[model samples]
Every structure is written in C-alpha cells, then in structure tokens.
Target chain A: MGEENVMSDDILVIAEHDGSNVVDVTFEMLSAARELAKDSGGKVLAAMAGGAALAGSLGAFDRVYLIDDPAVSNYSPEAFEKAFTHVVRDVDPGLVLTSTSTMGLDLAGGLSVAWPAPLVSYVVGLGREGDDVVATSQIYGGKLLAEVVVDSPHAICALIAGSFSGQPSPEAGSPDVETVSLEGIGPSRTSALAVHEPDSGGVDITAADILVSVGRGIGSKENLEIIEELAEALGAPLAASRPVTDQGWLSKPHQVGKSGKKVKPRAYLAFGISGAPEHLEGMRDSELIIACNTDPDAPIFDVAHYGTTVDLFDLVPELTECIQA
Target chain B: MVLLKQLPDLVEELEPSPDGTDIDREFIKFILNEFDDQALEEALVTKESSGAEVIVVALDEPEVDQVLYTALAKGADRAVKLTGVPAGTWVPTHLRAAILAPFVRELAPDLVLTGVQSAEDLDGQLASLLGGYLDLPHAAVVVGLEVKDSIARVVQELGSGRSVEEQITLPAVLGIQAASQAPRYAPISKIRQAMQAGGLEELEAPAPVDSADIAIAQVRIRRLYAPEKSTHAEMLTGDPGEVATRIAEILRSKGLVKA
Candidate 1:
C-alpha cells in the first residue's frame, strides 16, 4: 500500500523510438518532465516499447520501463496502446507526457480516454502552479496562447515540437530498466496493411544545412525556376509549404511542415510562406530565419530574424541576380 | 454522419479581450472549418459509393443556419443544429465529445466522421474522444477512406510523407484530413435553393453526463495571450532592387555567401 502511494506521485515520460534510433522528442519530454517533477516533488519515469537497449541511455529518468513484444516491432496503434496502458495502470503516474507526433497523437487520444484523464494537446509550455500542473498551448492557428491547468489526478499531454529544447541528462547515472511483457494483448480492430513511402527524387530537406522554402505565394510552377536559381546560388536545398507540394509544384520530399519533415537548418529563407503553426513547428528552430512575403502581417514575421514584404515574383529574380553578381 | 463547426476565420485581424482570456469576437467573421468542409466532402463521396445518408451536425452559432444550408447544397442529405450549447462559449473537446456521444448513439450511425483537427482546437481530438465514449475504433488524420460491407479501408497520414493503409471494423470513427478531391464548391444559387427547401432540424442537447461537468470545471483557463515576440525582425522596404541588395548585404555580412 505504501509503495502504491509512492508511485502515484510519479511523472511518466513516454519515450519514442524506432527500434534502433530514439526520437529527439523523447529527450525533449524528459527535459520538460524534469522541470515539472522538480516543482511537484515527483520522480520522472521513462517508458518505451520495443527499444529496450536504448532505455539505458535515457538516464534522465528515475526508472525506465520497457515493454518488449515482437508483435509491436512495427508501429501498431493497438499494440503500443496496450503496452502503454498497462504501464500507466501499473505505475499510476501523476502526469503522462508524449509528443504531438503522429504516433503520439494517435496513442494519446485513446489512452487519455481509457485512463479517463484530462488531455491537453499541442502544449508549448509546462510548469507547476500551486499544486496544479499548468500547460500553455497554442490555439486559433497559433494566434492565441491558452494557459490550461490539468485538474485531474492523472493528466496526459501531447507536447508540440520546437516548444522545448532536448538535452541529455547530465546526472551521470543509468536508469534501472524494467522489462515488462505485454503478452496476449487482444486483437486490434484496425490492421495496418502496408506503408507507402513518398517518391524519392529530390534532396531530403531534413538533412539540408540551409533551406530556401517557398509557399503558395510562388504563384505557379513556372515561377519555381527563380527560387530554384536562388537556392542553387546559395548552395542550399529547396523546400516548400504544404500548398506548394499539394499542387504538385514540388514533390513530397521537398515539403516541410507538421505533415512533412521537421528540419533544423543553419539558415532558413522562407519566401511567401505565411507562418502557419504547422509549418512553423517543423522549421522554427533554425539558427537564422529570414522571411519575405507580400503580406506584412503574416505570422512568419513574428518569428523571422529579418523580414520583408515584397512580391516574390519581382523580388526573386533580382535577389538571384544580386547573389550571382 | 459528419460533424461540422463554425470558426472565426483567422485570416482577418483578431483582437484580444480586456481580460485577455479569448479573442474579441465583436468583428471576427465566422466560417465553416476547413477540415470539416473536407470531412463533409468525404461523407458526400461515401454516400455516393455506399448509398449512405450524409447528415451534418453543428452547434448553434452565428450564421450556423447558413452553414447548414450550405452543407445541404453541397450534398448533405440532412442537417441538424444542436441546441443548449451557447454560442461563443469555448467547450473543451472531452465535454463536447461526451455531449455528442448521446446524440450520435441515438443516430446509430454506422460511421461517424469529423475533421482531424480544428483551427481553434486547443485540447483537440474530438473524434478520438467520441470513439472512446462510444466504445468504437477511431482513426485520425485519414486522407482516404472507402466503405464497403460496413468496413472502412482508410489511408491515414502519418506525417513526414508517410502513410499507412488500415482496415477498420464497422461502427468506427474517422477523422478526415482530406478527401480524394477538393470539396466541391456550391454556387450561391444552389445554397439559396437549399434554404428555400428548409430541411434544417434542431435538436436540444441531452443532459450532460456528470463526468463532463467535472471535466469542464477542471480545465480552468488561467489566461490567454499572444506569445511574446522574442526577435524584432528588421523589416526591409523599397523597390525589389533595393530589397534584393539589402538581402545580399545581410547574407554577405553573415558569411553565408561571398560578396
């Protein structure tokens, strides 16, 4: 009974990994959890399924729980949720933190409901205030920031990307890994038939050092050459917003956003891209950001280190000329 | 059935309230959510294929009647306006899902469809929450769906240009990201004709479950504010030549390019 009472105050961080490589968001959640745990006087526990070996590197947590199930080697929402739900029930953590990634969003929705815990998604900030855990989230397409207090005894949160910085734990001690088996988790109502990878013909923008990104304001496919020249002159990769890719002006590999790739280039030159929250979540952490859009009030200006309101059609050729000269 | 919502269009200027808890609604224009429009289009497509009924349910809001009529014009078979939830009130997703579950149960819909996420979604994931309440399987960010023999074959977007195809059992919920094609545009004349036909129905919201009340009380919004701008961007002006020169100079100064 006393051990159960002690476990109730624990904060659980769901570590995301793809069998071999641990996702950066896992470390990011550990950082956020550490801050919250400090104020709440709770221990941070990290949990993962299938990546038992990677658990030892997550020294940030007080304890690490690993669920090894061959059935969960791939990303099955049903299997992962079963493992996570089992861990949550056994540990009874005060707070559960997961990423706002595809898998995270998928698992969080069902888990929050099954646990009957309050869920706060797209969280950008987390803190503790007088016995309550507060989470700040963006709403209205990033125009408004809402401060929400999780009032349930147990709460689950999906943290947005670029909200918190991920740092390895400096505490210099390995986490004790406890392998739990989720055998006989019932059959899933949904079955993943196959995975379709996007056509690979272009540079992967996620690995680019510098990115010249375009959006809807590029107008048409013919105007793409001007930006292409600019990207070539700068020796940077070319990327685009969702609309550009959706229109087939650019391929899926060149798309950068929440639905696309999250990139952290040294410099990101955003042209005609209105900073929607989704797009910003992917490339907001660039070392230097410069945006040029026709609309001065575009949210891209809010995050850009340097910005200009100019028609890209007229501006791109001149900019390319100036660079080439 | 499809779930629709009216949202204050974010394209226009938004001013904060005096208390800074929400946007000032005095001048904001309201429109059907973009994703919900896509969801409606998906439902219409499903109806065409499976001979299913496409019913649109929306909360009572400013100009919502017009939205319902527009959905009708766009090929919805029926429209329902849920009463009792006040307009302009921010209802959390869980409570909204709880309130919607009873109505959905009564409808006995074979499949429930909603937008994957809304522009104003803070706590978000209404379809998933509703699925939980209804004890059904739910899929989010579904880009393609086909219904046959009460089963749904769906293509779910998994971000980073990856997608997964899934076969979900009957009586499931799908959060639509987009349909195979863009939502068809309904001419104003068609909408006017729909309004004249008058197929709109109003249903009073059922009594709230006890859990919904507690959930609402627990989600106390401490404040609402615009995020602080950490960097003051240098806004370049003048002709394209001058701006280009300035950009070149800036780039050269940063050693990103050789002058």
Candidate 2:
C-alpha cells in the first residue's frame, strides 16, 4: 500500500536565507535530507527564495529551485507559500524538509495546509521503516522521544537547529538551478513594517570557537565578573543561558539556547547552568562539554563530558586562577 | 480569547510506560502551560485597555477547572471547558484545530491568542494549524501585541533575538511567545472568590469529521523513551581548588588551553 502511494523519489528541502546569505540551518536541513534520501532512494532537491548564486556552492542538492521574485526579497509568508506550493506541485516530492526556524515554521505551517500534507515539527531524526518514513522528535520539552510514522506519502517535517551536522558537499558539482518566478500572487494579510536589529557591538557567539556559558546558578550580576575572567583566561567568548540574559546581566546575543544563538564550538564550559532542553539544543554539538552546577541532578550532566557539582561562587574564581596560573 | 492547556509539569521526573509509547502519567502533576498563561494574560491585558470580553477555553482534563478559575481570577470574563475527548488522549494539532475552529467561529472573536508552541506539542504547532483551519491570518512567536482600530500591531521574535514589527488586520490569530507585561498574579482570595462565583461553562465539543485524509495523516507515537546518553559525565568530586585544578588539566589535555 505504501509503495503504491509513493509519489516520487525526491526529498525537497526548503532553503532559508537572509537577503544576502544562506542561513546555516538550511544546509543542516539539506544534510538531513541527504541522509534520509539515501535510504529512500530519493534525490535531495533544495527550494530557495533569493540568494540564488549560493545554490552552486550547495553541491549536495540534485537540483535547486530558485524563486528570485522581488516580492519575496523579504520573507512574506504568502509569497513563500505560493512559490513553495508551486514547486511542491511541480516536483511531487516524497518528503519535504525545512528548518524549525521562525520563517521555516511559517512556511511549513502554510504548506501543510496548501499541500494538505502531514507536518511533524521539531524533528530530530528521520528514517525509513518498511516503506514508511518515521520521524523522531521530542515532546514535553525534550523529555521523551516520540517516533511518529509519517502516514502521508508526501510528509512535511521541520528539523531542529544543531540536530544534524551540516557538512559541505564532498565533491563540487554544479547543481542544476531552475529559476522560478512567482508573479500575480495576491498580498498577504500581514506586512512587515520594520526589523529591529540587535546592536552591532553585540558578541556573535555562533562564530566563537570556545564558550564559557553561565546560567541562573551564577547567583547575581556581580558574579558575572568571575565568569568573564574565566572566559578571558580561556581566551573564549562569554555566553549565558536565557535566565542570565533575561536578568540583564548579559546581552541577548550572549544567550546560548533555542531562542538565542545556536553555537557548535570546539569547547563549551558551562557554569551554574542547568541543561534545559532549550539551552542544550544550542550547545550540545560542542566537541567537549564541561559543566559545573550545585545540583548534581541538573540535566546538563547528561550531555557533559565532565561535570563538577559545586557552587559557581567557590569554583569559578578558583578555576579562573588555575587557568591563569 | 485565550486557549489554555494543562500540561504535566516539566520539573517532575518522568518514566516511559511499559509499552514504550508514552510517559506513565500516574505519578505526574499537571500545571497550566506557561506560554498559555502568558496568552491568557495578554487577553486580560487587552481587556483592561479595550473592554473586550476575555473568554478562556481549554480541553477537558484533570485540574482544568483550576486553570479556568485561575484565568477567571486573572480577569477573564468567561471560561469554557470542552468535553467529549477523554483526558490524556494525544489529539493531533489538526484534529484539535478542527474541533476548535467551529467553536471559535461561533464566538466570532476579533482576536484569538495561543501559545506559539506548547511544551508538550508533538507537532510543535497549534496556533498556526488552527489559523490554517480557520483560514485566518496568523503570526507566530509574537512578543508584543496591541489591538487598536481593528488592526493588530505585533512584535514578532525572529531567530537570534532579532524582532520584526508587523501589522495584521483584526479577526486574526496570534501565537504569543510572551506578553507585553508579566502575567499578573492572582491572589488566593481572588482565586477562591472566582471558584465560588461558579461561572465555568461546559460545552460539548463537536465530533471531529471522519475524514480518511485526516485519519491517514494522524501522527502515531510508536515509542517513548529517555534519550540515550551518548556521553556520560565523568564527575569530578573534591574541594573547589581540586576540582578547578582537575578542570584546568582536562582543558589542557583537550588543547582548549595551553599547558
């Protein structure tokens, strides 16, 4: 029954981009799509609006459907939905994948209705099980893994950030780029009035190779100096969980979590940080994770390579001194 | 109006059932979803300013009355409890949307507010799916909102803390991430007063249309298990000085710091 319902051996990934460059999660989705397509005997195809020139660099894609209309220069859900729906109808892909970013969620939500396909968001893993695609995701805030069978032949799913490592294409082969035009689409109900960019002086933690991240356990704003010194001693950037940033001790850019910067640094030193799923979603991919918290049962320990249960007040200063010495 | 859900509190320890399909709920404690609380607060705030009647709607569940009374204490004018679906049934978002769309239509609400995503969301989408089902303009992850002159101006949180301001005409859905202000605390006296007022209205949920498409598209939870810990923390136990020295050594060994 599943084989008879198969539409085509094509995995469509909706690529996301800022006006200038392709967002990193788009490649991550492509990587996941590539992995899933291997078992399904499907070709990985990427659908992107704007940033068409970058398509050539994405050699993993079998084909790139670029919608380069000025209307879509900025993300309007209606334009994106119309363009994506057109591509979905034209390609008739077996599976569609996108990042779980805000724009990705908007598009996938719209397409779920437009394509009338079943959507599974926050997908952490995808696999083929006896002709049915199984999507694994976290529910109840990452407490349990829910393995859902995509009953629809053409299933839509969104991949969470940092869930898959986005490796570049092994070999550079220029993918066939098809420029699609979306014209005469009506205006959407909502219109973007303005974008408020974070201050330019803010730290870009995503680009940092090493991060010393603090959480609510740091106690107060005055204690941040010790963590800052430790970060300086280690020659790494200082990052924080949502609580620290929310408390105004650190800037928003310094936050490491789902709603913040998703960093895959070489080393992550977490102090007083309990591993909420949101925080883990950002920095879990680090090569080495060292966490310190007063609570031994803090979930951060689950992903940490090394852990020390102690007050940050006692440990951080001593740790900074040791690192400096 | 605000849509609320009673969720198993996250702080509670959970274990998968013997069948490995879902968490064993017998020992769990249910609490109102935090985001939904914020949505309810947003509605109450709007009511404070615009005199709009705030109605709180929730699926029938254990401790749902507590949530509704809490909303009532927080200034919702009406509370609704939808019946027919048994507690703990994992109704997919689309089915929930199908069930609520008609009810919301009946209310003819100028604005509908829901949490952007629930902590227990299997699909991580309810507001968007509901918007699609209702064919209403919707925005997600909104941090701030103001309803004025039939136009809703919303501040939406984008990736990396960037935000965009957008205007959507009223009779739209908004998936609220945070309210403009912190949710007001309802005192014990107020909550008790609300419970005594006895204004909770129960409504029979419309039976979901039996569609083959929806049946086939429904998500099935095959297994539920604790995520296997790929890497275990090697606990370093000692005085602060000893632990710090050990951490320094480990950092040096990993080439994160110079020896």
TM-score of each: 0.89, 0.87
C-alpha lDDT of all candidate models, in order: 0.82, 0.80
User: Clashes in model 2: which pairs?
Assistant: none
For model 2, residues A140-172, the per-residue Cα lDDT tens digits are 767677888876667888887778889666486
**Which pairs clash in the backbone of model 1?**
none
Per-residue lDDT tens digits for candidate 1, residues A241-276, read 876775568877898888888899878999989898
| Interface RMSD for each predicted structure | 2.7, 3.5
Could you give the C-alpha RMSD of every candidate to the true structure, in order shown? 3.5, 3.7
- Candidate 2: stretches off by over 4 Å: A2-4, A200-212, A216-238, A243-251, A263-272, A285-288, A293-298, A309-325, B209-217, B238-259
Evaluated against the true chain A, what TM-score does chain A of model 2 have? 0.82
DockQ of each: 0.55, 0.51
Could you give candidate 2's per-residue lDDT for residues B71-100 as a string of tens digits?
999889999999987567566666777788
TM-score of model number 2, chain B? 0.88
**Per-residue error (Å), model 2, residue A146:** 1.9
